[model samples]
Target: HGSNIEGMLEAVELADGNPLHLAHINAYCRGTVLPEAEETELALKALAANPNISCESYLSPLNGTSAEIIDGLPGSMVTRRCLKTGGFTEDEAGMEAALLSGWAQVNYPQGQEMTLLTGEAARDYWRGQQTLVSVSFAVNPVGPRVRLATAKKADGSFAVDAVSTDGGGIPRNVLLAAGLALVDLGGLSLQELVAKISYQPARLLGLANKGSLTAGRDADITIVDRLQHSAFATIIGGQVCYMDGKVLGRGGRIITTAAGADYVRSQGLEPLVVDLADSSLLQKAQKR
Candidate 1:
């Protein structure tokens, strides 16, 4: 029988002389706690010392264990259709949903409560509001593997505090203030956490020139104030491109390149020209 760590321990006892395989052991507390790891090591050593029992543990990268949703997958067509009917422009619906879904899966834990409302509820809550939604899927072969959660204000406004977790197996780096110095400190200081842990993981991944206080690198840095989730300033490529949370630079520079313009124009064999007659159209055209 398939089981988590505790269940596996019981199975070991019940199997008597039979062989057993510990599958996806990391899903349980055994992988997280020091004592559990020690216990597992001891148990394996004991099993190896015995002549009758054979045991083995399989380990896989946590990311690799989770399910993957491929582009143009059959199941995704439902979401695609829903978004189109929901008044989302094709590109906006597809790209935005993909991006949000990815972010949600990475941060939230599995088995959390999620509600997908429709008709009046969806209209009352989500209409004309900027929001972020997140989901968590379990990597374990155990029961009830996927879960979702959402946070919103009383007036149907989406709250910034809406974050999800995959059980407690959230990445250590993403916790930022809560993981490094807070938790016991009543609450986490976002500013301090950003200054510390958030960038280190990227550096460790051989993005050497990406995250640093040094010069001549990418100059990609974010500055934030206390108690605010938004960054005060963001610099890239030795230029202060974003300040006061607003992006500057446009027209074939940081925001776009001349090559990008050529490609877009080439797509339809049309010369892209801006018409200032309509304010809305002018703004959209400028972005392109």
Candidate 2:
């Protein structure tokens, strides 16, 4: 992430033309960082000036943060920042108040899925969990979010390289739903949306086998219901992993560094070795 406009600029300077993929770019433009509009503008300008810096942003307004309070204060710097953003104290009492007021929502488990809970029940659930749970706040500003996602570079490439779901923890994995809405309104072409969400992301991760429908590409695919604007099914490595809101596949390969391979095997999972030298980021560094 570009944590903020300055953070993004600093990282770019530090990279010095090496490839840098910034995730959740919208998180940095929430008015807390140099006013939302200026932050968005600077972020886009930086991306355009530096093709070495790739970027992604989510569509959700609610952002994930730690609910854990330590020694009377929020444990995470992000949590403290969020509390201040909502005009609350940077303490435990403020978190409780935020939850009670619905400015904060607890991400609690409901059946096998995670759902957002606000109001009294949310505060209760959070207390029951000893404030160790994760919570989300509606902190992302709309204008910056939109601009960051749709900006174009000088060479006609996407300023923000992808639309990523910084979800799982916050449950705002609405990539297709939100992205397709942009396509429907002609803010983005279908191909552009796919390239942002799929093609470029694959490059960021160095997933050479995925991201395309070309003849020999891996059969990793997601079928979306355009009318409903939701994921219908997912196929990974030619196997059905998810269908009809159910996870069908038991296990998936863990892509990790060589040092993590032993731990992954100990957990009875296969690890796909990732050499840092081969990463696109480091490859650029090598060329430089």
Candidate 3:
């Protein structure tokens, strides 16, 4: 995450103005490989200058990676990365031993039980698993997290476009409560809050009818308890899906990219076209 931001920015620059959506950039600036504060400043500067790039950050302190993806050997860059910040051993045997010794947590099946594997058990699991296996790591810190979340233009609008959970089924979803918490701390205003969680993300995705409450827009919405900092109710397409911790509905449709564009065009729905190379989020900073 540390110097990865530098490399990612370089790639964006090399893309010759192609649109790029960077994910969980706060994790990259937290200084796993480079100094945190320095990298954060550099990242902010790069983002301010690049209108083509938009990114999101999650509020959680933990970031995750797949154990199956690591090379799991001495002298491998991934192995070195794990060893440097994640307390992994230098070699494959060491990694196995570390896994057995509770050095790494394995994401198991069933309820996604996080079991600490060790010794032969860990080695065996690694050897046997054909599909992907994931591991959690605490690679983020508060300094970069806060800085990325609050980055702003001269006009005080947020520079980091959105706050995403980046969590689907892995249970790391913290966008709702965490965003509300940020509002309570004066880190962001309510309108800005809406921008970060709803408007901005919708804009990023080119979902013209999803982010706002205006007529003809989708009724997908969530009501949050200001006092509790939690979701009070959930609505989707003018239907009450959930309220008071009870799910009132279940069923959703998945739209593939090809199908999505086709449906929109067939319906004569001209959604807003987002500029991938120059997002509205960085307008002020880019102007300055």
Q: Best lDDT goes to which candidate?
A: 2
Q: Write candidate 1's Cα lDDT for 102-166 as tens digits.
A: 32132332354333333333323332333222222222221111100011235532111112222
Q: Which number leads on TM-score? A: 2
- Candidate 3 whole-model C-alpha lDDT, 0 to 1: 0.67
Error of 1 at 244 (Å): 3.4
What TM-scores do the predictions have? 0.30, 0.92, 0.77
**Model 3 agreement with the true structure over 108-184: per-residue lDDT tens digits:** 55543354444566657766884256654556777887778878966666768888766545545667777788888
Q: Tell me how far candidate 3 lies from the true structure as C-alpha RMSD in angstroms.
A: 5.4
lDDT of each: 0.35, 0.82, 0.67
RMSD from true fold, candidate 1: 19.4
* RMSD list, candidates in order: 19.4, 2.1, 5.4
Clashing pairs in 1: 108-164, 108-165, 108-166, 109-165, 109-166, 109-167, 110-166, 110-167
Off by over 4 Å in 3: 1-3, 69-80, 90-103, 108-131, 259-288
Evaluate model 2: give its TM-score.
Answer: 0.92
Residue pairs with backbone atoms closer than 3 Å in model 2 (clashes) = none
